[model samples]
Target: MTSTKIIHEKKNSDMKKLLGILLSISLLLAGCSISDKNKDLSQEHLVLSTIWFQKSPEAKALFYQAFNIAKERVVEFNKEEGEKPKAVVVDLDETMIDNSPFQGKMVEEGKPYNPEFWAEWTKLSQAKATPGAKDFTLFCDSIGVEVIYLSNRLTTELEWTMRNLDSLGFAFVTPNNFLLVDETSAKEPRREKVAEQYDIILLLGDNLNDFAEVFQHRGDDWGVSVVEKYKNEFGRRFIIFPNPMYGDWEKSIYNNERGLNENEKFKLRRKAVTAF
Candidate 1:
């Protein structure tokens, strides 16, 4: 009876060891699978995927030019008696603030741009300032130029936007200086509103619409052509930052339709391209 019991006990111990080995192997395989899945996800192409504003050398150069242009414009505008600038006009997202983390989060979640998600993210009010923006803005403030942030963000997001800017050390002109776009999405009207009181000389932004009305609806290539037509105005009155992560350019390429599946859009994009 004792010998039989010993045999049974040895069998159970061997079975337990076998189970442990199998579990470790299964866990290792699962870890490898997750690693491969992450690699594949990272390879997915999104429009304006490059971090142009965050890491480009050209972007840094452009920021310097913008600062100089703003300084010159302020000086020129102030020359006129009682015509001093009430405020300097700047765009919010991609202009003064960096929203790359929001984009990164979307990529990680495998989700596209949704208004609800963006609205919630705005409420977080944790966006950092773009490189060189803080320094440029501080210089502007030192010279008595009030900072006005004009954004396409909804009115409901205004409080959060202001809080984000304030948290990032951005000084505001007045509560009114934070201009939220109306339902129309026409920036020309907003510019006109700013021009009424402020000696609006230099306009700073990442998109062409920030500089002129023509780029409001145009694509990046067309906007580039239009800007070339008025190259003289660039670096003088209009200062543009680099924003390759997302913009009207991508919308133009995709025909502004969010319903198109990723595969269908990629096929269409490939068809549209022609070899020179």
Candidate 2:
């Protein structure tokens, strides 16, 4: 055979081999993609249910400790001759109400935070009750310990919010008990309002500001410091629920806005991270 013919045959053979390898890799990756999608769907459903209804062991233990403390405080305060124990104030979203569905939609659609989306979701009145939240609130009611929901959720969502809680088995408190913030993003005023009506013995939430205004001005570092300062209140006057899926912690790492594109946010995140 001529050398030219041999070279052409060799090139053709190499090309065929490369094409076969590429096809194999493509199929493998496609399979992996499908598997990953399935896994994500399953995990999302499980997490959604867990957030809405099932309490993890850690959450249950924390709830029990807080419940006992609140119960004791109520009893002690009520023992007073005339003054009655006030109420247990709680944050609604992620504190007592499971917004996992909203979060799941965000994750699935690769969408960022948008007030309109949240407003619409809140109107759906489908958010389920967090585990132990319903029972605890009911217990507070049964014991005459008023339960108040102080939320950052807009006042426009009030009616739907109430309906959501009611549908989720959370006892509907009077309109006064639902203190939805009207406009200000700051929670100090809400806390002050609660203080006026309730003795505010116990404050429950997933964030530090839910308890005090110390970190309201300072950012994440100050928030962390404040949490450390009040570490003793963890299971006592301040009950917290775990919400790793989303919270101020995530916001601390990334700017809490939907305006930034994913790549921009990713670049920012990369800048924040470092390798030793």
Instruction: Give the top-scoring candidate (lDDT).
Output: 1
Per-residue lDDT of 94 in model 2: 77
Question: Model 2, stretches more than 4 Å misplaced?
Answer: 1-73, 76-85, 219-222, 255-259, 270-276
Writing each residue's lDDT as its tens digit, candidate 1 over 1-276 gives 699999999999999999999999999999999876764454255424545555667776766776677677777765556655666678889888888778777667766678998987899999888767877778777878777788899888887888888788876635697888667676888888888888775788888787778766565464667877889877677777777677777666677777887567667667667888
Give residue 220's lDDT in candidate 2 (0 to 100): 43
Model 1 collision count: 0
**Alpha-carbon RMSD of each model:** 6.3, 7.0
For candidate 1, the lDDT comes to: 0.75
| Candidate 2 C-alpha error for residue 64, in Å | 5.4
Q: Candidate 2 on 1-276: residue-level lDDT in tens?
A: 999999999999999999999999999999999876754553342345445434467766665666666667666655555354477788988778777777777657545558998887888988877667888788777877788898888888888988877777777556777877687877889888777656776788887777787756546463677777878877777777666666665566565555565556666667667689
